[model samples]
Structure formats: structure tokens, C-alpha cells
Target: MNSEIFSREIIVPQSAIDARGHVNNLVYLEWCLEVAEAHWETKANTDLKKKFAWYVLHHSIDYKASVFEGEQLKVETWIANYKGAKCERLYKIIRLTDQKIIIEAKTDWCLVNANTLRPSKITEEISTLFV
Candidate 1:
């Protein structure tokens, strides 16, 4: 269990842009989920995955700038904090060309039992893996 920030670079595809000529607002939400899943998959082992699952409870995003197709962006995510059954995950999307922040977001996730799909308390062992 390591506290490390996970990052991935992505190019804005044509399909991601809306009629307004910039990346769609919904696309940003999609990116948040994409980065979060990638980060979790990299850290959670097979046994952990089988035992626990995460469900998003809430999300907040701040759009700083608009992005267009072909633009390269870096998406970064990390587990910010956790208590009891819930934890917060943070995200940042930065445009590569000018180093502008495109969007910043926070998502609240609840740990749950894989089979029962019920809320599970995040014990010390599980908390250590993220925080």
C-alpha cells in the first residue's frame, strides 16, 4: 500500500467535443471516472477487488478552462482521505500546451461488500492502502 498519485495523458478526441466547439461537460465527468478506475485497478490486488468495491456517492468539479480536439491533457488522481465507510478522491485535468488547468474535481466514494453490495466500514488495513 503506497500513497502515490496516479496520472495518465490523453488526447482530446473529436468525439469528445460538443457543438459549442469545446470538450463537452459530460466528457469531463467521464474522464474523472476513467482516471479513478485506472488508479484503483493499479493499486487493488485480486483479493482486495474480490472483497471490496467502491461506489461513487457525490462529485464536484470546477471547470477552469475549455479544451479542444487534438489537445493533450494530463489527468491526475489520488485518494484524498477516508473515514468509516466513505473516502474522497481528487482529480485534476491540465492542458499540456499552455499548462492551464482544464478542470479539477472531487468524488466521494463508499466502500462496499462485493457480494452483498452493502456499505462496509473502511478498516485500518483498507485505509492504509489508500491513505
Candidate 2:
């Protein structure tokens, strides 16, 4: 698979903001999942989806700046590496108004059998899409 970066635009809503008047920590995590799922949906085919699924193994995030309500942000994600059943993904959340990077994150995901929920090897066809 080729190393391709996927991106999406997101708006910070009132519900996403915490008492601190900025986006909550958990909201950033949710955004990470959102972009990841969008990327997978665009790349994975029907047969691939039926054969395997991805489970988040770990997530590491750094909050560089606070995002306020009604702000527009650009979320970019890309696959960093893949081995066996596991792959690493990297993300950047940038504020559109000022072009500031508000968050930097990485998530580790494992391929698993869709039906049994057991870890499964990454097939050559699937790997090609991300390389």
C-alpha cells in the first residue's frame, strides 16, 4: 500500500466543548476515530471489511492548543507503519482560521477477525492499500 494522507473538515460544536470553554480531551479522541474510520471506509472494499476489522490498541495525543466552539478545523491522518496484524496511524488537528496545529496524535490498531474478534494477519491486498 502507498503512504497516503487522508483529511476531513470538522466543526467544533457546543456539545464538544467542556466547562473549560474549549473542546474536551475526549472529543479529540473521537475526532481521531472519525478520521480513521473515514480513511478506512474510503480504502477498504466489501470483501476486506467482511474478512477483517480494526481495533484500537493504543492512542497517544498531545494537546498543543485549545479549540473553541464554532471553530473550523482540518483533520489529517495517515498510516505510519504496518507489521503483522498491527499498524500505526498519525494525526494532526489544525485550526483553520490561523492554521495552528491544535493536536498531534498517534494510534495503534490491530487487525482482527470480524466474526470471532480474534487477531488476524494483514492480508497482502489490504496492506497494499496503506503502503
Candidate 3:
């Protein structure tokens, strides 16, 4: 386990399952956003969050295995890199029962001014949290 990673636990809900009887593709992305939001809220200060906000620029997910309803999952995420106003966040969704990786994903996020919604630099205060 990486010391820099932030982790969260989730349960597969029946509503998240598709007609194919497995978690839907979109649901995986939702989980990624959920965990990321949780991480930010927990780690970032109110003043920083009030000054800047993040917007997703891109998301890439590789489905390695299927997850079903009632299954427990561990979502581990960390900042892979940051440049200018953008950062790449990495994620791994593991099925706790067998300890298998169900999904591997990365999302590109850009920092933006909370009020103006324009691209903003990654400030030291924000960067230190991920580091």
C-alpha cells in the first residue's frame, strides 16, 4: 500500500447494477468522483476550497473484473503528478473478498478559480496535501 494514497470503502448497491447483472460502467466513474470528493473535503482547508475548485478534464478507466451487488470494495486513490494547473489522479478499486483489482483508473483535473471559473495554478497549500 502506498503511504500517499487515500482510501475509502464502498458497497455495491443493487441500483448500481445494470441489466447485465454487474456494476454499470458509469457507476465506476461515479465511485471515482465520490472518493475524490471525499479526499478533497477531508484533506483540504476551507479557505483553499473556497478559493479554488477542481474540474475533471479527462477520465480513463480499465475494467479488470466484475463487481456485484452487496460486494465490499476498497477505493484507493493518489495524485500521480501535477503540472501547471492540472493534475493526474490515479485510482484502484479492489474487491475485498478476494483482494482482486476490479478497476484501474486515472482522471485529469484542472484547478479553477472558484468564483471566476478560470484556470488557476496549483498553489503550495493545495499541493502540499497531495504530497
Candidate 3 C-alpha RMSD relative to the actual structure: 1.7
Candidate models: Cα lDDT each: 0.90, 0.92, 0.92
Model 2: pairs clashing at backbone N, Cα or C within 3 Å: 1-128, 1-131, 2-131, 3-131
- The top-ranked prediction according to TM-score is 3
The local lDDT score (0 to 100) that residue 28 gets in candidate 3 is 94
Per-residue lDDT of model 1, residues 1-131, tens digit only: 34568899999999999999999999999999998998778777899899999999999999999999999999988888888899888999999989999999999999999999999998887776655
What TM-score quantifies how close candidate 1 is to the native fold? 0.94
Clashes of 3: 0
User: Lowest-scoring 10 consecutive residues by lDDT in candidate 3?
Assistant: 1-10
Q: Per-residue alpha-carbon lDDT of model 3 for 29-115, expressed as tens digits?
A: 999999998899999888988998999999999999999999999998999888889989999999999999999999999999999
Runs off by more than 4 Å, candidate 2: none
lDDT of 1: 0.90
Model 3: how far residue 20 lies from native, Å: 0.5
Candidate 2 at 38: error in angstroms? 1.0
Better of 1 and 3 by TM-score: 3
Alpha-carbon runs more than 4 Å astray in model 3: 1-3
Using all chains and alpha carbons, the TM-scores for the candidates as numbered come to 0.94, 0.95, 0.96
Order of models, best TM-score first: 3, 2, 1
- Local accuracy of candidate 2 as per-residue lDDT tens digits, 1-131: 35788999988989998998999999999999999998998999998888889999999999999989999999999988889999999999999999999999999999999999999987788878865
Better of 1 and 2 by lDDT: 2
